[model samples]
Target: MAIGLSREQAPPQAVEHEPVRRRRRPVLVAVIVIAVVLVALFVGWIGIRAVLARQQLEAAQPSASAVVAAMRSGDVAGAKSAAESLSAHAAQAASLTGDPIWRLGEGIPLVGPNLAAVRVVASATDSVAREVVTPLVGVSATIDPRSLKPTDGRIDLARLAAAQPVVAKAQTAFHAAAAGVAGVSTASLIEPVGTAVDRLDSLFAQSSPVIDALGNSTKLLPGMLGQNGPRNILVVAQNPAELRATGGLIGSVALIHADHGALTLQAQEAGTSIGPWPTAVSDIPDATVGIYGPLVGRYLQDANYTPDFPMAATTIAAMWERAHGGTVDSVLTTDPVVLSALLKATGPVALSSGDTITSANAVPLLLSDVYARYPASSQQDAFFSSAAAAIFTKLAAGHLDSGKLLTAFSAAGTSERLRIWSAHADEQKVLATTTLAGALPVSTPQAAGIGVYLNDATGSKMDYYLGASVSAGAEVCRFDFRPTSLVRVTLTNRAPANAGTALPKYVTGGGTYGVPPGEILTRVVVYGPAGGLLAGTQLGSDPVRIVSGTDRARPVAVVPVQLKPGESKTVTVQFLNARQVGPGLNVATTPLPPNAGSTPDVGARTTVARIAHVCDSRVK
Candidate 1:
């Protein structure tokens, strides 16, 4: 019995325990094998989900581009089709990302926020496709461009009235989508997640304003266009050749009347009609008078020395009120390029002078060549009046494709070349929010508001051959000396040395204005942001004389640059008090108003670089 027990019970209990432990090992092994299989499958499923989501997103992007293109071209039906396709593809993408695998990814440590961000953005895009883009398609179809056309010298107010609600509803829906997009948070996300969010950010930024403008147009149209009775509007043509703050000198003016949409050009006048304000406008700011000199009060048209178009418009209205007893509903201001833009849709227009104004040659003929072609001021003035009257008559007669004309108007308005002001307070309130309002930009908070302005000091129209460029950047090369704001403005005189002899005396201001022929004398006025100080100014390697003073509490520095023929020199302006440069660096320049003379060999460029968190830089 003992031997049998030793063999059977274990070589007693020890033997029994050994086999039991062996069985336990196999059970543990089987559990581990099952776990390994599950882990591999789970990892593979997550990887596959990510790849599939990326693929679908890639497919949806092209469709999105098509939708944007169609929408911009006013192809409502095409946009709708494109948007629907985008919605379907985007929905599929969202569904794929909505799977359990992606939900699990949201629990991952480092990549969790990024994964969630992708889903949120995808969903938002899908929502926009449904709520904003789709509705706008119908709105476009509802509002017929031809309805705005005048018949029997009158507009069909009933058509515009019918379309107003459609536009208003679309506006509301677009604003909601913009709000939704604005509400998305991608704070913790990094790299491509942040980049992806930014991709569509500007789309909402631009579309919201456009839709709001369109919506306001629906409301303002009937009243301003005289759907009820009769309305009179003043149109001012600004000549950018002299380079005023807003655009150029006020060279021409016209009075347009719209009675029940029957548009007519009542009278065309030169800038001379309004003459001067008679006395200084009591409301004129001290800084404006100081910068523009006596001209601000001398002539009504010269009051646009401030970059604020509203200020100019208000001054114009008050001055005009003195001459004409009646009040105007609004004032529309446009530059030479605006005329060219309109002509693009209208084809060539024949002026009363028997001169044809084509889009291709409008700028040269009207702005520069006009002076060369007609030396006498009287002849030039007459020709301008005729051109203005001719355009008004043709447009009212519906001689152009209405859609293209609308698009051209849109182009002009967005480019800041076309501006409007309303006498009606309620209408102005709505317009103030849109880009068309033309109000002086509010001072950007914290950051320095450096402004560089150009004024012709030559007492002649010699700015035509002048090229100027301004740039602001951090000069990191000399980092040890407390980082300063480096602003460089370059001006070139491309005229020939004998230009005065070769060009007509009238074109050269008859040598009556100061300076040799072809020489460009410019007063470069550089204003430091509030709290910012001017450190120094340089002409190439040599320092230029800088006269400093206060402009509306902001520091102003004026530098005189007189360039001989074929001379190119750069003016470097340094600013000291840059406590809060902000995270963004602004280098601003406007292409010198499309060059007062030629089509330009080079264009004006404004460079903006964001170099926040740089070592040894003060960016608050």
Candidate 2:
């Protein structure tokens, strides 16, 4: 109590003795706070790095082998599930880096193995997932799914993005080229160039979105690495046409390959494998032959034999063998046109002994036999006609035969009676006929009887005969004749004694004539020498009679006559008759009793006198 009086000494003694007790609460609390903060910061940094790394890895993945395998194995649903899980994990990791709540978790020690596994799994999963989703994205990717190979999986986001601009540029160039092509006319040399341009345009239009996405993903690559890096990518075009069209857009990076006999291609980058390249160029327009070969072969097979589809299998086989030096079976699978062409070349082959030729090599044997038996000309014509007919039939039928007929024709050679058989065959086939006027006897006399006979009437049953009297008393005349339902007769008077003869008495004998007398007599028409119709009172009255010294002899005239069924008689008429005038000679006859005019009567005599006078004038 009095320590203040004794000040220093008393106070120091009491202070030490009172309590050696010390509180550790404050220090402990401060230590705990510092430890927590350090842990949080470290955790945050690690998490952020991991998330970023994971994102980078994910973006880099592009290989589709896993996805393809999954799909092939019918694990589509599983693949999708895996993809979703990976996406979620990536998203979670991304959040930990930027968000304060994830700070504690960030400091958690990550085993190197676990981290590497995550990255590997993420990359693999992404590659597969992307492939699975690519088709759903539509046709917007510069890379074709079909052309993609498993090794392409190694392509990182940066490379993919880099390729996008090239693809875009290529697309733009293609469109420009296409525009240039479009400006050209079909006849222009540049017209063919347009086909490539059009294809590129289509590809670019479809792949724009995918290319852009790829580019965006690639853009993120620089951030993923500690330092900027350069990457190289390989682009291969299986088709030369495609390469020519799109190569410019890809700059120097594009590899060009021509799909010829053995699907040849060149790679820009030495590391790329030729095996993955498409065996054929499917995207090019001219590549249709390659793309549709199988389809065409099928069509040929189904084609009708009557129409000769698929031509001949043996013929095709032979051609294939000749072209590629392969056996028939091998050629059939690789090139069906061989069979078709062969069949066509061989014509039709039929076995005289069996349903089919029984030779070890039926097609070749039959072809040899036909060649030996028939002349080249006959074979060619028969084969060609039969082939043509078969094609026509198939076209009309709207379907095809398996080319059995074509094959038969090809093997048989044109010498086979294929044409004859075809004429009677009920199967669909084309029928064609050509008619030419018959030859006339050189000695045939003017005003004499003449007839036309058809040489080949295989399909036709009836006979058609045409008759005409020669002008100027000529013994023969030429004419143009064709098959028809009607018969025509032409008469000309060239007798010096009957220059102005009245219409002659047309006598129909032998066979019952089907012409009416009025029609037979009324159709005579006359023309002046200058090829003008005769005028004045004569007009048509004496169409058959020509007045001598009247602006030269009458010009050639045409007369058309008709006959009634079962009628035969001689029609007597006078030239310049009052009833026959200027385009007024059309007439019909009334049925009369037979033999009524067997003898001459007063009227008949008068008619004859008038005709004689007309004849006399021309004779003078």
Candidate 3:
């Protein structure tokens, strides 16, 4: 080995490999630097997209609002312009949210759900802008609500029919958009994202009913308004001063004839004069009679005792036909509140009695003051007839602002102060889906309904001073493996402390019905969702006897509440074994005074599973 030691033999391999390793080190460093730069660029791009998308969404809201406002105000050009702006913002937002890189970012751990929520909102907004508002704006120029106003007592049905198809499409698109937003889960979303999603959900939920009603009206209006033949509709004016289940006791009745949208007042009479029919006017179900009693059939004023408006309208129409000897194709019920709402459009009318009835004084003059001014039934009837005539004359003059008129109809209809029933099966089929139909409480795929109806047991106008509100809830308990739902109805007597001595005898009933003067006896009727069972009822936290019955397959409980002046009471009803549940609950109460705007509270325990979708025995 010593003999072979030379300079080349010492480190030939080391010298050759040193430069190669140095070159490779620089190349590896460059690769890592490039990779880091690429990742940073990707993240930065996503951040910029998110910001732009959010800005687009925020900007679209005002455009959407403007479109709705312009349409309501009958500015078709403004609506179109706003619609275009909405479309632009919504499209860009949708595109930004739908990008592949954005979709990939939706998989990130803590930020993923928020990203997904943003995407969902963007998609829904874009769909609504492109599918719903755009088509509606396209037709807005042709189908003006103002054009539908009565001209010489006739509405132009042709224009309504022309816009029906497009209106129906918009309704369908709206429902789809609503479903898209409703399907997104908010559990994992951050607070801001969850709140934004919830707000969009609420808009869809509230607007669905209005859109549905529009579609239904356009579908049924032509036939119901006598496009095929002449139709006789009975208009029953309900007096809310004396509370009834639907609105109030029928005060005045008028007959209207409709031929191809032309309306004419054919005859007028007091509801009191209709009958005391010798027997039941229509064959009523025993269940109905058991709940409402025979008075509903024999007396026109008692027809609304049943909370079902169709039954009430049927009886009222039958009684009128028997007395007047004419066919009644339909029946409509409205109270003084509705008339006052319409007065805003009709302007002030001078009554034959030299009194001016404006929107401001219509309610008091018609409901409270009229009773005090004319004590006798006949004199009251004369005044009502005169007032009705004066209002009708003003309406016939055709000087109304159509927007205000529609707004009046919407307010009255939503509050249950106005209702309509069609005798024709086809027309009724469409109407049954509407609030105007006045059907009983039933659970749907989207909501569960409970009804709290008030019927006066006092034979007086004392309800003029009554105020009521309703709230409901459900419970879930592990120890108790049964469903339990509770309904609370709070009744307040707003009457003066000296109502016993200060009020008119007619208004107070003079204690004729065994109730003390100024005391209100209300038969409070509570109905649970269809196929539910009544567990128990309480009056002010104490158990009480309830007169129980069933209607439309729903459990009903009747409790009598007697309240003195300046008194308040709360009635509670408990329901068990609900046959169905829905994502939300709706409580339908008797329409109270216009000033009493009740907000319904309905919910279930957060821990329960399928509480909104299934009727589980172990949960409410």
Candidate 4:
């Protein structure tokens, strides 16, 4: 029929279908063009919102820091202004990220989680700025850390008490904000978005502790500083020249009495005046006696050998009570490094001997030069006592730059150069959670704890020139599916080649304790992660004798090494079968001399690199 219907005889239906097909093509093209335009508009809207939110966040981030700085400096007006700025910027950022359209984008396929994370971060940041930081700014003048400084030898505890409620409220709000930010999922996020979330989380985590410390200070300091009654605080000045697990041997001891915030130096004495007791001053823990020997309680110098500051403080307090009868309250320990830190606040202190100790010269003068300047123990002790008194005299004048003072204490606390132990159970419980307490190494779910402690066995000041460093790594390349950890400690004798003849006999030990002159003898103790076993120990490439024991359920390995002048050694301890240990390592070492250049070059160790990667894929 179609062949017959050709030329002028074409069918009517065929003619009609051609024009319809032609018309539908134009309509289809129009529909596709409209769809492309709409999609472009939608993506552009999301991009604009994200850009605005990010810009607002960038503007607001600096305000929180400014508020903290201003409040610390006791500038109420500046703090208030910063708080307002923070509120304004954070609120805008939160609004931009929380709109209906922005939330709708969070329901999209591939990029949904990224959008969701940004929104969560914005909301949490706004909540913290408005809820915690702004309210805290109101009470900033009252709880200023600078204000906590002793004015006329008395800190006004009433200020802390008055601000307690505000600080507590702020702490609660900050924790909630932190938890909220922590809940955001980083997976499936774009690189920039993931990184922003990570940095935000880190800021929250870091600031949470500061708030916690503030809360703790307001809560605990009033009672401990004797707002209601008299309290005694023992001050131990540790000398790091002769290394001990906790800084060094307690060289000088002092007692301070506090009543209604008033402080008075009750008494001061040399550590030698205290006991090498006839027996342990208190019942020493079996683990302590086994790892550190009974000398931990017998001798004041050996009290900190166990690396548990509370135990050490208790033993020292007992001995102090025995020698000078009084109720023991709390103990504070500081080393020359801490003294150097404090010196930055006190300025240069002039001694009676016409010598000056500045922050620049404090470490060398106190830890080394003092030994050389005084040949007799009595003379050295007198010099130390005089130096302590001079520093105290400067501090008592109360003319300090409050910022410098706080920085000094913060640095000391961070490095564990300064530590405190309270006799009160409640106070100790709080202190246990802080680095200031010098508690034993604590393992968390994210990190495995290991401790490398050093004690001087040479009975000399030689450790002033001894350098030490600790590096740790973990491996899961075993068949048993348990982690294997290694803690490597490098010890170097930085003494001069002629130290035997050039150094004083007292400083060199003069062959005392079977260590040759100018030689350093150190007893190294390694504490494995809790519930771990000591596989073995190595001194360089050879097996070394290790006295194995357990402390606080952690396996302990002790090794002794003696090095002559200009010598170095490495001690490695292997820990096996550690249960529930994280992929990361938390390694703590004894505080070394400020001049000790002992930081390990981890990148140079191929073994560490290989083993550190074994758990990368398997662990979370």
Residue 375 deviation, candidate 3, in Å? Answer: 2.3
Cα lDDT listed for each candidate: 0.69, 0.26, 0.82, 0.83
Q: What are the root-mean-square deviations of the candidates from the true structure over C-alphas?
A: 6.1, 37.2, 6.5, 7.1
Q: Considering summed lDDT, which 10 consecutive residues are worst modelled in model 2?
A: 240-249
* Backbone clashes counted, model 4: 0
Q: What is the C-alpha lDDT profile of model 4 across 249-314, one tens digit per residue?
A: 889999989888888888999998888878999878898899888889898888988898888899
Tens-digit lDDT track for model 1 on 1-620? 33444445654233457888989999999999999998788777766766776677778788888977886676777887888888787777677677777788889887787777677667667666666666666666555565565555566766666778777776776677566556657677788877777766767786665677677878888888988778888888887666666666788777788887778887677886676755765367767776566667657667776665677788777666666757777888887677787787688998777789977778888777888778787888998888887777778777777777776777766666677888889878877887677653333433455666676666555666777777675433233333446667788887778877776665555556667777777777776655656667777889777666666656677788889888988877766544443422343333265654444211123333333222222222
Residue runs of model 3 more than 4 Å from their true location after superposition: 1-49, 99-115, 190-192, 444-448, 469-471, 477-481, 490-505, 566-569, 580-585, 594-620
lDDT of 2 by residue, 1-620 (tens): 33354455554553463333345566678899999998787666665676675564444332233433454354656545545554454444434344443444424354333333333333333332343243322222323222121121122233344444544454344344334333433222133223433443453455443333333323332222111332111221111000111100011112112111111112221111111222321121222222122222222221111011113222223322333342222101111112233334334334323323221333232222333344443442354234323432332232323233333332222111111111111211211110000111111111211111111111110001111221211111112211111112232211122211221222111112433222222232222222222222122233433222111222222233332323222212222221111211211111110121121110110010101112222211
TM-score of each: 0.80, 0.18, 0.84, 0.87
State in Å the error of residue 281, model 4: 1.7
Question: Which run of 10 residues does model 1 get worst, by summed lDDT?
Answer: 600-609
Clashing pairs in 4: none
In candidate 1, stretches whose alpha carbon ends up further than 4 angstroms from where it belongs are 1-59, 66-77, 92-107, 143-198, 202-224, 227-231, 437-448, 475-483, 511-513, 539-548, 551-553, 577-583, 587-620
